[model samples]
Target chain A: GIQVEQSPPDLILQEGANSTLRCNFSDSVNNLQWFHQNPWGQLINLFYIPSGTKQNGRLSATTVATERYSLLYISSSQTTDSGVYFCAGTLQGAQKLVFGQGTRLTINP
Target chain B: EAGVVQSPRYKIIEKKQPVAFWCNPISGHNTLYWYLQNLGQGPELLIRYENEEAVDDSQLPKDRFSAERLKGVDSTLKIQPAELGDSAVYLCASSPGGGADTQYFGPGTRLTVL
Candidate 1:
C-alpha cells in the first residue's frame, strides 16, 4: 500500500490568482492521477501524470518519480475551479489506488 | 464518451433495509472499480473487477456488502441490513484495463442510512 499526503489542507484565493498544490507519495507508483471533485460531487479527472510534465489548458501537473512527489499548477483560477483537489497513486504490481485526503480550494469572486 | 453511469443519484433508507446501486461502465472498459467516499475525505477503494472476475475485494465488508459485475459490463453493489454508519457516497469508475490506465468516475450515489 502506498501513502499519499497533500499539502495546505485548505486554500483561499481571489479569482485570477494562481496556486500550486502538492502531493507526496510514500513510494514510486505505476500510476498517479489528479482529480477535481466539483461542487456537484462529480469527480473529474484532471491529469494522469505518472512521471514527467503535462499541461491541460490552465491546469498543468508535474510528477518526479525519483522524488515520489507531484505538483499541480492552476493559473488564472476562476470561481468555478473551487473544489476539492485529490491525488491518488497505484503502487507497482497493485491494482488499487490509495488516495490523499485532498486540498480544499475556494476561489472568491 | 458517456463516462460512467450510475443509478439513483441519492438514496435514503432505514437501518437494516436493503439497498442497491447500479453502475454501467464505459463501453470497452475491462476494469471497473467501486469506491466509498466519506464526507470531507477522498474516495477509498472497496472492490475492483477485471471484466467479469472480482480481482480485489479484500476491502469490502462482506458481512453486509456484496458486488457483482455480470457479463463484464454492468455492476451492482448491494448492502443488506444497512447500518447507520453505512452512509456515504458510493462511486463507480472504469478504466481501459491496463494496470496503469486512468480511471474515470461517475457522479456517485449518495446514501443515507437512518
Candidate 2:
C-alpha cells in the first residue's frame, strides 16, 4: 500500500491571498488528481495532473513523479475557495486511488 | 451528462442493523468503486468493479460487507449487522473504463450508527 501525506493539515487565509499545498507519496504513481470537498460535501475535481502543470482559473497543480510529490497553488483566493483539498493517486492499476489526509482551507472575507 | 448519482444522502440506524447504498455511474463508465471515509481522514478503497465482475475487494470485510454490480451499470453495497465503527461516509466513484483515468465521485452517503 502506498502512503500519501499532505502538508498544512489546516490553513487560514484572508481573501485575495495566495497559498500552496503539497502532497508526497511513497511510491510511483500511475495517475494523480486534485479534488476539493466543498461545504456541500461534493468532491469537485480540480485538476488531473499526473505530471507537469495545469491551470484553471486561480488554481494550478504540478506533479513531479520522479520526486513523488505534487504541489497545488491557489492565487487570489476567495471565500468560495474554503474547503478540504485532497490529492489522490493510483498505482499501476486503478484498483486503488490512495488519498492524502487532506488540507483544510479556510478563507475569510 | 449527469455525474454519479447516489440515493439516500444520509442514513441513521442502530448498530447491528443492515444498510445498503446504491450508485449509478456515468452512462459509459465501465469501472466502479466503493470507498469508506472516516471523519477527519482520507478515503479507503473498499472494493472495485470492472463491469459486472468484482475485480478487487481485498479491503472489504467479507463477513458483513457485500457489493454487487449487476449488468455492469448500477451497483449496491450492503453492510449487515454493521458496527459502530462502520459509521462513516460511503463514496462511490467511476471512471470510463479502468486504469489511470480521472474518477468522478458521487455525493457520498453519510451513515450514522447509534
Judging by lDDT against the true structure, name the best candidate.
Answer: 1
Tens-digit lDDT track of model 2 for B17-38 = 9999999998999999999989
How does the DockQ of candidate 1 come out?
A: 0.83
> Which digits, one per residue and each the tens of the lDDT, describe model 1 over residues A4-23?
99988999999999999999
Predicted structure with the largest TM-score when compared to the true one: 1
| Reference-based TM-score of each model | 0.98, 0.97
Q: How far does residue A43 in candidate 1 sit from its true spot (Å)? A: 0.5
Candidate 1 collision pairs: none
Model 2 chain B lDDT-worst window of ten: B95-104
TM-score of chain B of 1: 0.98
* lDDT score, candidate 2: 0.93
Give per-residue CA lDDT, model 2, range A1-109, as digits (tens).
8889999999999999999999999989868999999977888889999899999999999999999999999999999999899999988654478999999999999
Candidate 1 - CAPRI tier?
high
